[model samples]
Target: MARRQVNPRDLDLVIAAVHAVDPCPADQEAAWTDRVRERAVSLYVLGDTVGQDIARLDAAKQFTATLLDVRVEASSTRGVLVLRNTSGSSSSSSGPTAAIPRPGGR
Candidate 1:
């Protein structure tokens, strides 16, 4: 009976991820980035149903962060975005966005 709004932090997190993965080559236009961003958000939103862990919006501010930090920063490294926790517990979120290290130190 109501339309559920997606989280803004969810968006911020996804966009950061898109920038890291696609980085928009010089040849690409705004449309390309838009598409990429849209796709990223869609995927992230669908994470729970897609069988992935969900992170807290406030905990992850950087392109990558552990489950206590929430600050954004520029990053090219691929990683998972995890929710920040005051302390580690077996009951992890609904988490995780992180910058996975490049293979062979690429």
Candidate 2:
């Protein structure tokens, strides 16, 4: 018996497939966003190297961007990091480790 190593690309494909299935109902938008973030992070940790693939990463970013965009469009006040500081929170891990975003704009 032998343990087989999974290719990083295969993880990305799995994450992509997860997104395609629409895990949550329409009214449960937050849950849907959470799912995407969770899957994205798992993909990242699995060595997906999204930065190396602009198009694929861009698709992931769009999910976060849309969440932010909706907040802005609503004209309601909400802190981006404050809202997402949990499991699917936006943080240093979301971006390049070498150039992390500073808190409160430094």
Candidate 3:
């Protein structure tokens, strides 16, 4: 039996699907994020270099990290996720990773 090759685009779809779903209970959120992160890493490790899959995987990892941060903030604040830009810096010296705001304020 042969293993099937996984596409990096599929991982993007998975991330979008996860984002589309309503927030799960706080207890389960970590598991979901962990699983997604693990899958993304695994795909990255197994992906071929011909298609720039590595770059896509890197983007996915960043997206996953931002998602996890948002989930944690939402859970901690009881669903109110507030994002503030500090000092108009493009990159943060230290702090949480910047997240893209969801449309319609989520």
| Per-prediction TM-score | 0.28, 0.27, 0.25
Worst 10 residues of 3 by lDDT: 63-72
Which segments of candidate 1 are over 4 A away from where they belong?
1-8, 50-106
Please write out the lDDT profile of model 3 over residues 1-106, one tens digit for every residue: 9999878687675675566555566789887776666665555455555357657657763311121123323433223323344443232222233344445555
**lDDT of all predictions, in order shown?**
0.55, 0.51, 0.50
Tens digits of lDDT, candidate 1, 24-85: 66877786778777777767677665544334544545433255433332354454344544
Q: Candidate 2 clashing pairs? A: none
lDDT order of candidates, top first: 1, 2, 3
Best by lDDT: 1
- Deviation (Å) of 13 in candidate 3: 7.5
Candidates ranked by TM-score: 1, 2, 3
True-structure Cα RMSD, model 1: 14.9
